[model samples]
Target: MTSKANRPCVQKLRCLLSVAVGILCAQSLAFRNVDSAAFDSFANLTAKGLDSIAQFGPAGSIALAACLGALFYRIYPNFKRVGKRNQLISVILSFFLALSIVVPRLMKLPNVSFNSFPNYVGGVPKWHKPIFWMVASIQLLTIGFTLAVIICWLMRKAADLVECRNTGEVSTAIPPTNLSIWERGVRFFDGKPMHMTVATLAMVLCWLPMLVIQGPAIIGVDSMVQLVQFRTGHVWDPMTMAELPGYVGQDHHPFFDTYLYGLFDELGLWLGQEVLGFRILIVLQSIVAALAIVVSLIWIKKRTNLPDSCICACWCLAAILPAFPMYMSIVLKDSTWVSIFLLWMVAFFEVIYRCNNNHAIGWRLVLCLVVLGLFSGLTKKLGIYVTTVSLLLAIIVIRKQFAAFLISMLVPAALVIGFVPMVVLPALDIAPGGPQETISVPIQQLSKVAILHQDELSKSDRQAIDRVLDIDHLKPYWQADSADYAKHYGYRLNASSSDRKNFILTWIRLFFRYPKDYIAAVPYLINPFVYGETYYYSGPVRCGWWEAGGSRILTEYPECGLSYTQGKIAIPLTNALNKTPPFSFIGSEALYTVWLPMLALGLTISIRRYRNLCYLIPTVVSWCSLFLLPAHQVRYTLSFLFVFALTIALPFAEVLTKERNISN
Candidate 1:
């Protein structure tokens, strides 16, 4: 019996293969007159092939709309509903109607060809046969639009499922009664007062100086055209007086600046003024970000049952932190990305804890995913890391939605792993052209320079230098340096492949062996509080009270606060009584005294009450990860520091409030 079943299965497979071969033969016969080589070349044409595709653009777009509409209608039962079906059909018809109307309009306009090609080149094979291009383009558009529709339908179905589970029984006419006072206050304020106050104050204090540095040029007081031209292309000129163009491009790694520049370009088209408009957008985003922070506080307060005042205090601490002002002033992507992330976090918490409406949660999550995907794609690649971590955490934390979690995670993961490789990598040309080689010019030159001055170096320093040059160790350092250089330059180094391999290996070994050397180079990684270049401006100024403290007292103060106060002050009588130390140890003791205790307390409280406050873990992990990355720059660390401070301060403030309430 088993043999008979296997024989039939094999026969069926063979029959299917025969049919497939027959179809292929028929297709070949149908196109027999076409030159195979010409057809092959046309099929594999490059970007120029798009022109051929455009000939049937209208029909292709309409076909695409129809196919996508049908696919979506099948996948989503909601679309099958009478009202939904009508809406979807109307949308599809309207899209086609618009395309039909627009095509004629497009034809009437100028051809606007960026390339000059003769209408017909005799004896030259066309890039793509016009009819073939039309059919292929239509198919491509149909598949693309179909996939989009399917995704949207899947999201809608998921959301509806959640809604059914969470709110199916609730009456639409009834309002929820369990609202918190904080929520009420949020509604009362209309969300502007808190944001404007925080952002304006931060900008005035921290960023005003930098803006003044550019002064009249900002407001078009100088020749606007000249200013724009100077800033755009003269990015590298020392004479331009502006800090080297922060924007990353095809040539360099100004990671955060690239996103800002992209945003500037986008807003410029809409606002009609590029530079001034971009500045206004930055200011507005900062304000919105500040407001989001406040709204998040309110959401947290409502959900956690924490006091409004405590949450507000945490928000204040975060906004007023010294680094906060400086970061907000610059049109960098980090601050904006962080602010958006915070807002998402707030929405996530609201759905998870307060709303209890899974449908709403699903929609919010989808919105977050879309925002995250676009932002990550446009900004730094680190957005991928952020999204991955968030997704994994969601899976673990919301185990009931494990299936949904897996599906949702796949969207971003596919984007990063698939689209990145297929699209972004090719566009950027990041793939190695050949076997890698070690390019050790940078390391070799540095080592040679050091060797020349060996006699001038101390014995210990000399030995350390010698260790760095050992081929086994040096290979890793060289390799890593080459890779870094490539990343920095936005292109692979042109060198022997072996040199690239050796350079990478040498850099890796050096990095692990003397991690501090590389890590210390990061601006914010070391001591986040200290602003290196602008340390003087950032430090506290001396006042009358500090002058009253006298010399010995001032000497013991940390460099940051030295101008304000030095050492412990004691009256002569008090000093004479007992020789016991009057103050805490200055350096190490002072450094750890505040931050360590708070960190320890915060960690202890958070972990012990993880179930109750697990949301805080992401905030903690984000900051700690920032610390561990190569650059420990203060600005980078400051972003997480504020997160940490807010986490701890909010709870501590609540405890104080509770105690006061009991006393009252």
Candidate 2:
């Protein structure tokens, strides 16, 4: 004890003895006095710090805290050793993961109010119990920090693997001289060329079973409206005249989609079987979409240094995911938009690849971009913004190819944006949609404020709101999850530009006055995607005699209909597939639109692969666009899944490859 070296060893022994004693005390307290049922409930409500108090009594709480401190003492050093980028990514990913876990539980907890004014404005919640908040905060911070440590370790290992691969230090596992049957099966297609024909055939075959079950097309409400518009030369609603005063066909939905559906309907009518037209259309869309998926995969294989097995796995996923086949059978513009957008993304990425490698740019490629750009921009409203913004970013990065990129993207996009809205819609006598569509989020925010704080509204604020909405009447039509009823059914469509402007200014002013309401509105609407609320992966076939909000279109047009012919097989199989664990995860919209994107971007950034991030541009921009749009419905995020397939699957391909000298 007198010697300095001996004192250090003695101190270490003392610390170990104290930890052992505390752990023993904690165990004794837990077994002696705790009521299992009450303790379990309390544990569910709060973090373990508070749980220790309930489960182990006051004395053991102190011991548990000491034990936790020591545990952190051991963990801190490893966290400090990682690079700054890795540390940052670990923190961000941990926060997201913790929220993903905690949010659903908190949302579903009975008698707990999460959306009170005080909660949104950084004050005590309606629960008003300091102990509850203290416990909740402790749990959240503890879970987050714990996840950060785990993520840091994982990233470090991944980085090491990547470094080893880059330096040719890591080697693939060697199979035994006597390979097993399973290993032999895996090795059979190891080096075979993944041609487009074979790949497309595989994907199309995956879709054919669903088509056979719900043949002639599975129609949605929007599809029915478009079909009716074709037959009558007007949108299904006679209300268009009420809104716009003299419009027959409105460009409210994409007119191009309407025309296409009309032509297909006409084709079926002329062929003497109306259902035949829809069947042909569904089949053609499936085949074309399958081809586009394969094309994108082939392009990715050529451009990136990913393994063939990885590419094959991705093709398998695209072919088998329930959403792809389900949407292929359904008549929605989103399916067509995604297919064109896939081609457009490939063409755009190839241009960037060529520019980066200093290869000569070709005219055929530029023309392809122009043509695809035209179709992509015209496909959906969001496509215009995605293509235009991606092109601008490309120009900024590859300034050497500025004019070519600009003309390739900008010319087609510019012409579509300017001419279509200004020239084409008017020429076709189709009035552009009302401003109500774009103001979904703002109107939703207004609904929350109006419903909760009507007594506090100033007179001028009331007038501004009254121009676009009747606050007193909104409550009956208000839905927390969507602004559809509120924006369209409850809105004053006659409101002019100046009226909208005044309302927008009033909205901004009131946001400062009632910040809590504005803040709470977003999560309320998007809880399905962000807060783990359950949603349908696909809907049942709406064919013969089904109604859209009690519309008579299906009842009236009996000849132009088909039914779900194999419900006995299709229904049970669909339910089982959706409820299955891994399949369920793959089909989830959150995986595509939120979690996967966040995870992929985080990993890439952590590894400092900045250039590789360009592949995520289309997906990230499309996701961001949801904030300003009407809703974050599953169909809206369908493109995210296909767009991200190549980029997100890259790491798996690289890490598992037998080849050692892969580039990062």
TM-score of each: 0.42, 0.74
**lDDT of prediction 1:** 0.38
lDDT tens digits, residues 167-232, model 1?
445233534475555444334323456654654355344444433232111111111212232234
lDDT at residue 24 of model 1 (Cα atoms):
29
Candidate 2 lDDT, tens digit per residue, 1-664?
1598797775677566446544443332222111112224455433543554554356646656476446544554457668787888889887886565444433422322322111111122223445444534554566567657666765665566557657777335656766545343334233244545666777899978777765546676666666765675444342222434355566667778878877887888899876677778888888888888777776655455444455667777877766677778777788778888888887877776666556656888888888888887776777878888888877776676776777887787777778898988888877776678777778888877988887889889888888988766778777655677677566786789999999899888898898877866665445434423222234444432233232433333343443545456555556665544345556655666666767667766666656566666667677567777655466777776776565564343232234333221
How many backbone clashes can be found in candidate 1? 38
RMSD of each: 29.9, 8.7
The lowest-lDDT stretch of 10 consecutive residues in candidate 1 is 113-122
**Candidate 2 overall lDDT versus native:** 0.63
